[model samples]
Target: MSALVDMNAKSGNLERALKLFEEMPKRVYRLSKFSGCSIATLLKVCKTTEHLHHLHARIIRKGLEQDQFLIAEFITLSNSLASLNYSSSVFDRVISPNIFLWNSLIRGYCQKRCFQDVLSVFIRLKRQACLPDNYTFPSLIKACSSLCNVEGGKSIHGSVVRHGFEACVFVGTSLIDMYGKCGHIDDARKVFDEMTERNVVSWTAMVVGYVTVGDVVEAKKLFDAMPQRNVASWNAMIQGFVKLGDLSSARGIFDSMPEKNVVSFTTMIDGYAKSGDMVSARFLFDQSLDKDLVAWSALISGYVQNGQPNAALNFFLEMESMNVKPDEFILVSLMSACSQLGSLELAQWIDSYVSKSSINIQQDHVIAALVDMNAKSGNMERALKWFEEMPKRDLVSYCSMIQGLSIHGQGAEAIRLFNRMLTEGLVPDEVAFTIILTACSHAGLVDEGWHYFRSMKHKFCISPSPDHYACMVDLLSRSGHVKAAHDLIKSMPVEPHAGAWGALLGACKLYSDSDLAEIVANRLFELEPRNAANYVLLSNIYAAAERWIDVSLVRNKMRERGVRKIPGCSQI
Candidate 1:
C-alpha cells in the first residue's frame, strides 16, 4: 500500500495517492524513507493547508519526520509560499542542519526583505562551521542591496574573493546587480569591467544599474555596446528611455521589438501619459488586443493623470462590464478621479469597495487615498473623518493633509499640522515644505512665511527649489512689498520659472507698477512664449496703469503667437 502511494505521488497522481492513503487502515501502512519523500514531494503540489496538514500528519505518523531531505524540502516549500516563520519553525526542527539548510533559510528570509535576519542567519551559518557557497553569496548580497548597505555588500564581495568565486560569471552578475541597487554604480562598473566572461544577464544588469541611477546616457551607451541583446535587455533600454522622458526613443525601440509582451505595451502607455502625450497614449491603448489588468491600469491611470478624470471613471465602468477584476492601482486611480470630479457620492461608493476589497490594500495607503479624495472634493469635514481614524500616517498622508488644508485656505491649520509633524520627528521632504510655504503665502502670513523659508535651508538643509522660491515671491508680493519680491527674484541662484515672474507681475498689476510689470512681462514672454497667462497678466497690469498703448501691444503679441486663455472650470 505504501509502495502504491509512493508510485502514485511520484508519478504526479496525487489524487490517487490520497485515495489510497484513505482506503488503507491508518496503522496498517508502514511507509519507508522513499514513501515519506514522495509524500513530501506531494506536499509541494498541495495548495490548500488542509491537504498539507494531512500530509504533514502522515509523515509524522510514519516516523519519517527526522528525514533531513524531507525536512529541507519542507523548508523550501514554506519559503516558496513566503511564510518565513514556517521556514524558521521547520529549521528549528532540523537536528543537524547542513550548509544547504542554512542557505535555504537565508534565501527565504531575503525574499521577505528581512535583511537583518538574513545577516543574522549568515552569521549563524558561519558559526556552524558551514562554508557559504556561490548560491549563498548571491542571496546575501541581495539582502545587502535591499538594506542599501553598500559597506556590508562590499564585505560580502571580499568573501566572494576569499572563496575564489569572484570571477565566476553567475556570481559576477549578482554582484553587479547588488551594487547597482545599492546605489554604487561605480563599483558595479568596476565589477563589469573585470569580468572575463560576460553573458546577456551581466550586460543587462549593468544597463539597468545605470538606469536606476538616473544616468540614462551611460545606460544607453552600454546598451548599444552589448554584443547580443535579449528581450530583457531591450526592455531595460525602453525603461531607461522612459525614465529620461525620451518618449521618442522609448517608442522607437518599442516599435522595433521582435515581440512585445504586456509589460512592453504597459510601459509605453505609461511613458506617453507621463510625457503628457495623451493622444498617443490612447492610440496605443486602443491598439492593444490583449489588455491585461496592468495594461488597463496604465490607460486608466493615464487619463486621470492627464486630468480627464470623468473619462477615466467612465472607462473603468466599461472595464467592469468586461468582468476584469479591479486591482489596487485601479481602485486608487478611481479614488483620485472621483476626488477631482468632487463627486462625494462616488467617493463614498469607493470607500465601501475598499473595505470589501479582496486584494488587501494596505490599511494606511487606502485610508490616505480616501482622505485625499474627500479633501480634494471640498469635503473637508469628511476628509477629517477618515484621516483622524487612520491607524498610522506616512509621508503621503501628511502631504495630502497639508495640501488639502492649504487649498481650503486653512493656512493656520496647515501650519499647525506641519509643526506637529516636526514634533513627531517626521522630517518634512521637499513636497511637505512646498505645501506649508504655499499655505503661508496664501494666508498672507509674511512673517511666518519668511521664518519657514529661511528654515528650509538653514535648519532643514533643504535648498529651496523654484517652487519654494515662487511661494516666497508670492508671499512678499501679496504683503505689499512688490519691490522686495523683485529683488528676491534677482537674487535667486537658479533661474526663476514662469510662476515666479507671474506672481511678481500679478503683484505689479495690484500696485499698478506698469514699468516693473513691463520688465517682468518681457522676461516671462522670453521664458515661456506660449503661456497665455503671462500675456494676460501683463496686459491687465498695463490696463491698471492706464497704459492703453502698452496693452494694445500685448494684444498684438498674443495674436502673433496665437495664444488664447484656457476656459475656466468650476467644481460642481
Candidate 2:
C-alpha cells in the first residue's frame, strides 16, 4: 500500500496518493519511510497551503522530523508558495541541515524577493561552519544586487574567493551582474576582464551594465569585441541605442542581425511607435508571421498612444480574431481607446469580457482604468456606478472621479471628493493636485484655488509646479481680475510659463486691452512663433480698441511669419 502511494505521488497524482494513505492502517506512516516520503512528495504537487500544513504536522508527529531529505522537500515546496515563515519553521525543526538544504532555504527567500532574509541565511550558514558552494554564491550575490548593497556584495565576493569558487563560470556571471546592478560598473568590468572564460550571457551582462550607466558608447565597443554573440546580446545593444533615442542606430543593428526574434521585432516596433512613426510600426507588425502577446500589445499601445483610437480598436479586434488572449496590458490599452471615443457600448463589452474571464477583479488599477475610460468617454453616470461598485478604490479612482466631476461642472462635488481622499489618509500626488486646481479654475473659484495652491506647499510639502501657476492665473483671469492675474504672473518665484502668459493674454482679450494685448502677443510670438492665434487675438484687440492701423500691422506681421489662423466653424 505504501509503495503504491509513493508511486502515485511521484507521478503527481496527489489525490490517488492521499486516498491510498487514508485507506492505510493506523501508525503506517510512523513505521514506514515510504509513507513519509510519499506525503512529502505530495506536498510538492499540492496547491493548498492548508493541506501542506496538515501534512507538515503529520510528518513531525510521525517522527520523520530527523529525515533531512524529506524536510528539504517541504522547505522547497513552502518556498514555491511564498510561505517563507513556514519554510523557516521546517528548517528550524531539522537537527542539522546539509549544504543542499541550506541552498534550498536561501533559494526560497530569493524567490520571495526577501533579500535581507537570504543574507541572514548566509550569515547563519557561516556560523554553522557550512561553507557556501557555487550554488549558494549565485543566489546570495543576486540578492545583494537586488538590494543594491555594494558593500555587502564585496564581502560576498571575498567569500567567493576564499571558498575557491571564484573561477566558477555561473558564479562569475552573477558577480558581474551584482556589481553592475550596484552601480559599480568599474568593478563589474574588472571582474569581466579577469574572467578565465566568457559566455554570451557574461558578455550580455557586462553590456547591459554599461547601458544602465548610460555609457552606450562603451557598451557598443564591448558588443563589437565579443567573440560570439547571441540574440540577447544583440537585443541588449539594440535596446541601448533605443534608450538613447538613436532609432537609426537601433534599426541599423536590427537589419544587420542574421535572425530576428520576437523581442527584436517588439523593440523596433516600440521605437517607431515612440518616435511617432506609426507607419513603420504597423509595417513591421504586419510582416511578422508569428505575433505574440507582447508584439500585439506593442502595436495596439502604439496606435493608442499616437492618438489613433480607431486604429487601436482595429488591431485589438484582429488580435481577438486570431484567438490571442489579451493580458491586463492589452486590456488597459483597449480601455484607453474606449475611454477616448466615449463609446458606452465598447466600454460595456470590455467590462463584460473582464467579468467573463478569471482575471483578478480585485486588481485596483484595472478597476480604476475602467472608471477613467467611462469618465473620458462622456459617461459620468456609468463611471460613478463603476466607482461605487469597486470593492477596493485606490487614490487614482478618487482622482479620476473628482476630475470627471469637475469636467461636468460639479466643482463642489470634486472638492468634497478631495476632502474625502484626505479624510481617508490618502496623500494627493502632483497629478492629483494639478487636477484639483484645474477644477477650481474651471468652477471660477478664485479664492478656493488660491487656498489650495498655498496648502499644496505649506501643508502637503508639494511645491506648486508651472501647471499650478497656470491654473491660478486662469482662475484669477476668468473671475474678472485680469490685472491682478498679470501681477501674480510677474510675482511668481519660478519663471512663468507660456501657459501663464497665455492665460493673462486671454484675459487681455476678455477686457479688450490694446496695450496689454500688444505686450502679451509679442511674448507669445517669441515663445510660440508658429501659433497664428496670438496674432489674430492681437489683431482683434486692436480692432476692438478701434486702432485700424495697428490691426493692419498685426495682420501683415502674421502673413510675414507665414502664420495662418486655425479654421473655425459657425453654428447655423
Candidate 3:
C-alpha cells in the first residue's frame, strides 16, 4: 500500500495517493512504519493548502512531525506556494531546528522582500548557535541590498568573512552587489579585488556596480577588460550610456555586440524615444525579431513621450491584433497619452476595453493613470469613483487625484484630500507641496496658501523651491497684492525666475499698472529675450492704457529681435 502511494505520488496522481494514504490507518496499516521517502513524495505532490494541513495533521499523529527532512521540505514547499506565514508556523513547530530549517525560513522571508524579517531571523539563528553556511549569505546579503541598507550589509560581510566564506564566489558576488547597490562602489571594488576566484556573475556584478553609480567610463573600461562577457554585461553597458543620454555611444556598442536580445533592442528604443529621435527608435524596434510585451511597451512608451499619442494608440491596436496581451505598464502609458490628448471617446474606449478584457485596473499605477485620464477627459464623477474605490491609496494615487482636483479648480476639495493624506501618515514630498500650493493659488485661498508655504519650510523642513515661490507670487498677485508679490520676489533667496516676474506682469495688466508692468516686462525681456509671449504681454499692457506708441515700440523690438509669436492650436 505504501509502495502504491509512492508510485501514484511520483506519477503525479496526487488524488490517488491521498486516497490510499487516508485508507492506510482505517485498514489497520502502521502509519509509523511508513517510509520517509513515500511521505516526502506525498508532501511534494500535495497541491492545495487544505491537503497540506491534512498531511501535516497525519504527520503529527504519526509522530513524524519532527522529521527534519520532511519539515524542511514542508517549509520550502509552503513558501514556494506563497504561504510564508505557513512556512513560519511550521518552523515554529520544530523544537530544535537545525541550520537547514533556519536557512529555509530566512530564504522564504528574503524571497518575499521582507528584508527586516530576514535580518530578524538571522539574529534568531545566531542566538540558537546554528552555523550558517554559504547558501545563507547570498539571500541574506540580497535582502540588505534590496533595502539599500549598507550598514546591515557591512555587518553581514563581517559575518561572511568570519565564517570563512568570503572566498566563496557566490558569497563574494552578493557582497559586491550589496556594496554596489548601497552606493559604495569603492567598497564593491575592494571586494572584487580581494576575490581570488571570479566567474561571469562576479565580473558582471562589478560591471553593474560601476553602471549603477553613473560611471560608464569606468564601466566601459572594465567591460573591455573582461576576459569574457555575457548578454547581461552587454545590456548593462548599453543601459548606462542610455541613461547618460549618450545615445550615440550606446548605439556604437549596440552595433558592436556579437549578439542582440530583446533587452538590447528595447534599451535602444527607449533611448531614442527619450531623445525625441522617434524615427531611429522605430527603426531599431523594427530590426528586432523577438517583439515581446516589453519591446512593444518600449515603442508605445516612446511614442507617448514624443507627444505622438495617436501613434501610441495605433501601436497598441497593432499589439492587440498580434494577440499580444497588454500589462499594467502598457496601460499606464496609454492612459498618459489619453490624458495628454484629453479625448473623451478614446478614454471611454480604453475604460471599456480594460473592463471587458479583465485587466487588473485596481493596480495602483493603473488606477492612478485612470484617475488622471478620467479627470482630464472631463469625467470627474468616474475619476472620483475610481479614487475612492482604491484598496490602497499610495502617494502617487493621492498626487494624481489631487492634481486632477486642482485641474478642475476644486481647490477646497483638493486641500481636504491633502489633509486626509496627512492623517494617513503619508508625508507629503516636494511634488505634493507644489501641487497643493498651486491648488491654493488657483482657489485664491490667500491665508491657506501662506500657511502651507510657511509650514513647508518650518514644520516639514522642506525648503521652499522656486516653484513654491512662484505659486505664492501668483497667489498674492491674483489677490490684488502686486506690491506684496514684488516684495516677495525681491526677498527671494534664490534668483527670481521668469515665472515669478511673469505672474506679477500678468497682474499688472489686470490692475493697469503700466510702470510696474514695464519694469517687470523689461526684466523679463532681459531674461527671456526670445520669448514672444513676454513682448506680446507687454504690448497688451501698454495698449490697455492707450499707450499705442509703447505698443508699437514693443512690436518694433520684437521685429528687431526677429521673434515670431508661435500660434497656439487646440487638440481635439
Residues 319-388, candidate 1: write the lDDT tens digits: 9899989988888888988878878678777778777878665566677888899887667887888887
What would the TM-scores of all predictions be? 0.72, 0.82, 0.78
lDDT values for all models: 0.84, 0.86, 0.89
Could you list the CA RMSD of all candidates, in the order they appear? 5.9, 4.4, 4.7
Separately for all candidates shown, the number of backbone clashes (residues 3 or more apart, or on different chains) is 0, 1, 0
Q: Candidate 2 — which pairs collide?
A: 342-377
Evaluated at residue 58, the lDDT of candidate 3 is 70
Candidate 2 scores a C-alpha RMSD against the true structure in Å of 4.4
Quick one: best TM-score, which candidate? 2
1-572 in candidate 2: lDDT tens per residue? 87887788778777787778778887676565767666766776777777677677777667788787777788888887647887898898787789989998999999899999899999999999987899999999999999999999999999999989988989999999988877899999999999898898999999999988889999999999999999998998899898899999999999999888988988888888888899998898887776788888888888888899999999888888988889888888889888778787888887788778767756777788888987766678878888998997778899889888888788988888898889989999889989999899899987788888899999999988888889988999888898888788778889887898888888888987778778878888999999887888888888888999999998999889888888999998
User: Ten residues in a row with the worst lDDT in model 3?
Assistant: 26-35
TM-score, cand. 3 vs. native? 0.78
